[model samples]
Target: MPNIDATVTIPADATFDNTLQALRRSPLDFVSNLVQTHDDDIVRLPFGTQDIYLLNHPDFIRDVFVTKSSYFAKRKDISAEGSYLQQMSGVLPLFEGQLSTTYAPIMTEAAVNAHMRWDTMHQQRDFLKVDIYKEVMQITLDIVFKTLFKVDMQAKAADLVDAIITMDVGYGFDPIAALLNDLAPPVTVSMTSEAQAAHSYLLNFMLGLVEASRSAPLDSRSLFSWLLKQQVNGQPISDEQIADQALKIIFSMHEVTATTLSWVWYLLAEYPNVEAQLHTELTNILAGRTPTFEDLPYLPYTEMVLKEVRRLYPSVWIVGRFVRDNISFGRYLVPAGSIVVFSQYLMHRDHRYFVDPDQFDPLRWTQEAQAARPEFSYFPFSAGPRQCAGRDFAPTKDALVLATLAQHWQARLAPNQTLEPYPQKSFTPRYGIQMTLHRR
Candidate 1:
């Protein structure tokens, strides 16, 4: 048994009313402040009858995700019937071994097509001034759609984008509700009418695609077609199962990559020095041509820029898992039935692992610099077996998209607007990024 002497629990009484007040104000800021103020590696926050333990050290994070992963459950109430999200999460692991081999060629083709589409848009002056976040979101939606279903979704992009945003807002995390649910099992949470509509529209949209594929000749290259042909216990998978996986893939591919690419443009505009280095590298490497999968190995600096953006603003900033059994971190014992949460936002910004953590420096990702830091100190896509299934695909897509656009144009931030990070399902800009594109 492990000793619990070193564990520190923040009281729930009036003395720490400020913590509760801060939490009400902004959960992200509250968690950040709590981690910084306490020196302990593990800090527990008591709410009602349960405790939420924040793991602040890298080793503890490793233990939760790697060393003792089986002792943690991804969802708090695993015994309950799995929701759509739960079903998606449970099914993702089945595709991990096949993602890189099956999707790399499709991603590369999509990236080249994205380049051609942008070139045509630029010729028509449509890329001159626009909301880049929305633009990238649409681009990613099209790319992911083609990659998954081998069909063009450009015609329905507008409706799909609207539905996606609605779904995000509708299903976005609510801390207060989460706390209540943990304190009391199976809380009946409600969604807005808009969210309900979005939910129905997205589900129907996916179902329609699945239905259409049943009669169409199967594309040897499409993930959707491949999934449709998959068998379990010698039986083909169900339409609902395929639809759920497709929806999950859409969210993973579109939202995360779009948010990262949006930040990439914003950061490049903010730091001309890094942008200059990137341009020089791209010019030297590709000489004004669209990049391919083969060009990736030569574009190390470009990858570094994407890495820095991921470090500064990870799409999935925080991840939480429920402790399945008593777990020990050094001398501290974390009891079963508690939620153990870790923040990539906090770990990436930690001063111990990074020098001037807030500064956007791509050189920090240099092999030498990376070797000097602890392995778990920087995990934007997370680590271990449960890491994102698209971990290999997202960066490749982001790099290609970034290389394609930056090769011919530079985005300048539009005048008179403040950019703030909104801690949504993905860390998105509260007000979308507005910019004017200048030909290079």
Candidate 2:
């Protein structure tokens, strides 16, 4: 393949330093601007001292993610060096299909629906709105514990949750130390020591859970028990591997769902009229009852609202893949071993697919409206075979939580406060969202 004219445009004002700074500070806004002014197919960004490529076009995204996934496995070169950041970097078998045959059934639509109502009932009884963030942490802990470990952490999971939250995502002290390590060799050893010290706290907690389960068979209802049955080429699963996969699934399921729901509440609080319409739909269909597996189809409007929020502020916003083989698309050819990224943040906001692009309109995602577009247009849960194994969980969880929460309580943003989306372990509120919950 010939090297096509680098048709990619670099903004005149977006210098290498400024571009990286922008990406670090606020990634969504940076990508949104590129989508507004530049073509969606490709844009080059310079981070620190390295050049990075950002791919936005759906066709290019499809080529990078679906049609060519084998050649582009998930790899994060930029953030993978730091131990504190590695917790957020590793991909589990769920995303890679290693656990598909073994683990998929537990997260089936019916199962997730059943789990969700239990969550909603508890949240309603607890008055979750005033303490929504903490409630999110508890729900994720319980869900992961019950689904994966077969044991309820119950009240004892607090220390474990605290440890998990302390894990970093590149920009914190770990990345800064890694940066120092690169700059000065003398201090590298100390930086590495500190990073390991921080990681040990979380690692030990996960290992302890694994050991406790072995001594006493909990419920045998979770992924942990399922792993106990698993054999790779005939060897039983080891404690180390179980710890990694368990920690992987536990954290993976927790933060993304937690932040997404936080943003859902933030969005609903931002728009009371949308909440009114959503409540109406839930009122008519659910009749002051909790949502079940059978009730979701009738709650299309509620689903649409959640989809719309996800489109605007997706939790897993930017996806990265390393190119293993040279692939050509249009005028550009990506060479083998090149790291490329496709931003859902940019593509979801592209004018070619969305009319206003920025407006939070749930109606735009109606079945008729969505069918009119290309298959790769919206990917909150990603696309193709490698998409999130837990995709079914989020929407089911959201529908149940949103619908049931609407029944007993109405909410709005506290005066003078608004949420700003930021990149964290996943897309998240830059500041904690504060809202006033009114009893309905």
lDDT value, candidate 1, whole model: 0.76
Candidate-wise lDDT, in order = 0.76, 0.63
Candidate 2 matches the true fold with a TM-score of: 0.75
Cα deviation of 202, candidate 2, in Å: 4.3
TM-score of model 1 relative to the true fold? 0.85
Candidate 1 clashing pairs? none
| Candidate 1 lDDT, 1-440, residue by residue in tens | 54554555664442334544555468688788777877786778764455778888889888877999888866566654134245446446443544455555655555566556666777896557777887788778877786657778877876888787776666644554443334323434567789889878888899899999888988766667667876666899899888887887787667677889899899999999999999999999999887776788999999999999999999787777778888888788788887778888889999989999999999999999999988889888877756776677688788877887788788899999889876754678767788987788
Residues forming the 10-long window of minimal summed lDDT in candidate 1: 178-187
lDDT of candidate 2 at residue 180, scale 0 to 100: 18
Candidate 2: stretches off by over 4 Å: 1-22, 35-40, 46-51, 76-131, 157-204, 218-221, 226-241, 416-418
RMSD of each candidate relative to the true structure: 4.0, 6.7
Please give each candidate's TM-score: 0.85, 0.75
Q: Which candidate leads the pack in TM-score?
A: 1
Candidate 1 off by > 4 Å: 1-5, 12-25, 77-105, 112-127, 169-197, 217-245
